[model samples]
Target: MPTPSEFFDPSFIAILKLFLAMLLGGIIGTERAVFARQAAGTRTFGLVAMGACLFIVTGNYVDVAYLGVLSFDPLRVAAAIIMGIGFLGGGLIIFRGDSLHGVTTAAGLWIVAGIGMAVGFGLYLIAIFATFLTLLMFTGMWFVEDRFKHWFEEVKGDSR
Candidate 1:
């Protein structure tokens, strides 16, 4: 008659988890949006993360009985994620003779998936912390790389 199982029920908690995935992904994505200068920005990353999380959560349901009986292999969802991630990462990588583009975006998407996965499993704390760390690493890497480049140039000049 009514809801059979809380897991089966479309509860606010489930929706909230999905929302959290988007927000956490966006938090890290903001940097990618403006700075990485990729076609896929804040909206893209946010949407991908939330969409993946929903896919995982819904995959866990999916009325599996249609095939034979209702059963889910969370690992299947994880495997799908990994396969899709490889494609996304490849999308971000472009060879331009001697330089590359979209590597940052690729890495960002990769990290965002972990955040999304954490949210899917209802690990809110991990999701939050991961979001923060992702941002820190994303922002920090540029400065560190730039400084290292300058140092290398200076050392070369001294050697000359």
Candidate 2:
């Protein structure tokens, strides 16, 4: 059977990828906002993901279109993106007296950026799976950490 016309159109595929990246980022960001109460929320994350997707998709297009005029390395852009996100994440983190805050939020931003790149590179399944894993870590691990802390306190009390 012949494939649908939309499947062959690069524009359509790019739009779809951008949309999916935004959706995935929004999901992760919502969890962070509502549960973790992080500063970066749904709209911020959605914009980040879509921005990464656009960068990668545009880089790929340029590389393909100008195959001989100049050399274009998509990895270069990806690396820059990682570095840029690191700066943004660093800004989100704050060190106070004997405590640090926004570390998880910073890390989540970095990972969500990677997820956006994956969507841009046509790895939909991997991106989706990673999104779910991120949510599981953010939500499920909180409960686990609390229980472990409680158990440790109980054991310490008994020993004393």
Candidate 3:
């Protein structure tokens, strides 16, 4: 039998994964948190990602401990997490008369959950790439959107 330290050392991978999830979530949330329109902030995003990772890690632990004798599915836990995150995302959206706001924030919540899952599954590269792309979308796309809005308004004014 191995010592306690040796037995517990293997679990460090899960901790690393969860930390990555938290870091990615914090990056995304930082961008949103700076804006006044966002409903979810850094802490919320961090928690969501970390929470998702925790569930996946826990399910995996149970599955491994039981081996083939018991059927503990990590995918089921993932599915449930997705569903719950969806509900939470819905809460971020606000529908107004002519426009809908908070859609981006809601989408962020959903994608952050996905990032967490990827990390939990040991897909570090995938999670990092997704985080980079998400940040680009959130930041770069804002400028593009603003420019297009300005151009559209100018065109509309000239037409009138």
Candidate 4:
């Protein structure tokens, strides 16, 4: 049997962080899938979050292990992750004349990456709160946006 301390080991904590990241990402992705009908849903968001968390955790481990031997900036890994996510987000966006699609989905992916990084850094409360806020934005803001659109259309029609 493993000792209680073993459960609190760094490796175990890292795994926990990854799991939390995935769970949070999946929650956002589920909202997108069910409501937004986006193609990149739970699996995509979960993988993005998990991959980001893995990069951060591994970077931290490398930094600590090479403390005196080599100079390593873990923040560089985070910057790289953000840049990569930006590239991915760009791919999600499509512009056609007067309309743009997938902007919100791209933004969601970006925020999801940040959430993963926060979880990797053990900012559990912040990550959870961010996830909640994200859900609110996705669902609540959608309703507000739709209402505004309808109201604007009605006013426009009356003016015409």
Sort the predicted structures by TM-score, highest score first.
2, 4, 3, 1
| TM-scores, each model vs. reference | 0.84, 0.93, 0.88, 0.93
Candidate RMSDs in order: 4.1, 1.7, 3.7, 3.0
Tell me how far the alpha carbon of residue 131 in candidate 2 is from the true structure, in angstroms, after superposition: 0.3
Give per-residue CA lDDT, model 2, range 11-120, as digits (tens): 88889989999999999999989988888989878888888888999999999899999988999999999999999989999999999999998898898899999998
In model 3, where do residues sit more than 4 Å from their true spots?
A: 1-8
RMSD of 3: 3.7
**lDDT order of candidates, best first?**
4, 2, 3, 1
Runs with alpha carbons beyond 4 Å of true place in candidate 2: 1-6
Computed on alpha carbons, the lDDT of every model, listed in order, comes to 0.79, 0.90, 0.88, 0.93
Task: State candidate 3's TM-score.
Answer: 0.88
Q: Could you tell me the lDDT of residue 91 within candidate 1?
A: 83
lDDT of 3 by residue, 1-160 (tens): 7644366664887888789999999889988998644769898998898888888888888898899899787889999999999999989888899899888998999999999988888777998899999889999988999999999999999999
Residue-by-residue lDDT tens digits, candidate 4, 52-123 = 999999999999999999999888999999999999999999989999999999999999999999998888
Alpha carbon lDDT of residue 150, candidate 4? Answer: 100
Choose the strongest candidate by lDDT: 4
TM-score of 1: 0.84
What TM-score would you give candidate 2 relative to the actual structure?
Answer: 0.93
- The 10 consecutive residues of candidate 2 with the worst lDDT sum are 1-10
